[model samples]
Target chain A: MRRNLAIVPAFNEADSIAPTVAAIYQWAPDFDVLVVDDGSTDATAHRASKAGATVLRMPFNLGIGGAMQGGYIYALEHDYEVAVQVDGDGQHDPRHIYELLDHLREDPELNMVTGSRFLASSGQGFQSSAARRAGIRIFSSLVSLITGQRVTDPTSGFRMTNRRGIELFARDYPHDYPEVEAILLIHAHRLRSCEIPVLMQPRLTGASAISSTQSVYYMVKVLLAVFVGLFRRRPIEAGDRPAMAVEHAL
Target chain B: MTKITLQRGLAIAVTLGLLLLVFELVRRKRLSERYAILWLVAATTLFVLAVWKGLLTSLSHDVGISYPPSALFAVAIGLIAMILLHFSLAVSRLSDQNKVLAQRLGLLAQRLEKAEERSADARAAPVPGKRSALPDHSEAEAEAPVPAQELSTRR
Candidate 1:
């Protein structure tokens, strides 16, 4: 079996880190869980360590992008064949990791497979608030239009990536509000991505980083990032050997 | 008139003071020579304009500004804006470097921890036939606290 790594980026989620780590281990025993303690003031690192997950402690908070990049870097260094991103708040279901992984393995062309809540017609899980949903819809439409791909949930962080996706993200990722732009990045490099239906639950503990008041700002910032990303030069060739060389040099 | 002379004196003094301040900062190592170059150019331009009254008047007239001191003020503001923009770019670069440093630090720290654990485990259960002088040296080292600081620096 290909080595799988679950990268959980947690910020002050001591209350939920243990359970989240344990659940991932229980569901995906074959996959190794890595909890990136993003400079949490609480005992998040200790709790995650106690839960039997390898903990990577950042010297300071680098937000989600930096934290996840740290995990990708680790994945690259350890030569993991597949990398899964699971949120630390226990909102993302650990059971769905296999489904995402299967999708990646089944499709040779697909570089990334993201778990989307809106993909299913039954709506069995927690769909975000109406306003946030509207924001997600706007992003979904924009990303789809930009990439010429159908992306129902661009904001879904429950994603699995192959070595190529891991290399791209580990090299360059947006600092804030990264998930939506990540799809655009994959497309920029001519990498293929798709989504699968997955059930998501409301966060178990603390309030969301993006509140109602910050939603408008978040929307504008992400839209601007997506627009600006269009102007960035794509460096990878068709073969992707240059990227591998750069990674090796690093 | 005495009023015009006093104004000229004040302008000369201020520009000279700025030039001296920049020199002092660079000399004391508070500011890098790279940044000091911009300040030095700005202060020198202001000093030249201050001492040369006819040059300022003619330059302001050429720029279609009736008031000469306002021209000086405009130039000073433009220079300051450029300096601020330069500082902003520097800050953005510093932050990018800082994030990379933090990420690398975290990754290396984790690697160090794993190495320590592996060494500890090896010490805990030494293979009978595998034991050698090298293993004894490592065991002695493991008995003492791991010199994590030294190891990190070596990397």
Candidate 2:
């Protein structure tokens, strides 16, 4: 039996976490939901627990990267076959989780599958502000250039990773602007990645952590981080080097 | 004594004051011995250079500087800059350590919560024939750990 763990990284989404947890339970009961409350000042942990989700309360806010890394570590420790990350603001619909899992299940070659909001055929929902979209576009282009793979949504947090992907991220994940760099990291580790079309809903409550003004700064920093990843050696084991390197070498 | 000697005397006095301060800080445990060593070396070097006036004159002549005191000022500035740079590097290391500590604390807190929950569940469950529902509560506690972030060093 393939065990799936749903990892929700929430920061002060008390208003929206309940319904999100409920949606996950209703839509994907097969997957065990774990909400990592990232030192929320609100009732996020309480509401998530009441909604029947396992709540892991962080002592303080480690940002989104920290929370997701914690989830990955939990998944790795619990021997979960796969772990899917869902945002707590209810932007990522739980229904699409099955779509991502479907790809990972059907193809043994794939290590990770991400949900993209900007697919042309997919209906438009909330695409965020123009500045943020522009930033995402730049990141997508950069990731595509490096990985030799077209990625429409490099910044999407709604993604699923198999055991190998979970283990890699559990050991080493970017502390800031992880989504885009994560794609590059997966490539560096010789992991296969794919993207699926999924519509993003409007945020349920609370403003985005990155404001409009900070979008430019976010883009520059993420680009710098990704650039640094270009020079980074693959995180593969020594004995299996030639095979993995040949497969992923650019 | 000449005007240069007066200035030299003041510089020596200031160096002595700073050396005393570093010693006092080390004695009070306000500054760790590791860091105090740097400050001590800096102060002692400055004191020696200030007292050795002939060395400064000869060094200034060799360096093509018209004024000997200018060379003294230059050496003092250069030494202070190097010390400041070393302090910056130390601070950077401390900051990285602080980040790791914060991350570990958060992960440990999560584990503690899980252990408490397991024990609570074990206590609340209906036992039959002295067999608890959670048979491996201690085992769970022992294995409870969640890593916080990418612990791997960046290239």
Which one is best on TM-score?
1
Q: Please, what are the lDDT tens digits per residue for candidate 2 over residues A1-250?
A: 2278999999999999999999998888889898999889999999999998888777778778877877776677667889999999999999998889989999999999999999847457778877678778878887888899899999999999998898787767777668987888899988999999888999998998887667767778887887766775665332211322122211
Please list the C-alpha lDDT of all candidates, in the order they appear. Answer: 0.87, 0.81
- Which pairs of residues collide in model 1? none
- Mark the 10 consecutive residues where model 2 chain B has the least summed lDDT: B146-155
How well does chain A score by TM in each candidate? 0.93, 0.91
Candidate 2 residue-wise lDDT, B56-149, digit = tens: 8899999999998788789888888988999998885574444345545655676687789776876787575334445544445457543444
Candidate 2 Cα errors over 4 Å, as ranges: A234-250, B1-7, B44-118, B121-126, B129-155
Report the Cα lDDT for residue B91, model 1: 84
Which segments of model 1 are wrong by more than 4 Å?
A: A235-250, B1-4, B129-155
lDDT string, candidate 1, A25-70, tens digits: 8998879899999999999999999999899999999999889988
Candidate 1 residue-wise lDDT, B1-155, digit = tens: 32457878899999999999999999999999999999999999999999889999999999999999899999999999999999998887778777888988998899899889767877877887444425634565666655889768656
Q: Provide the lDDT at B117 for model 1.
A: 76
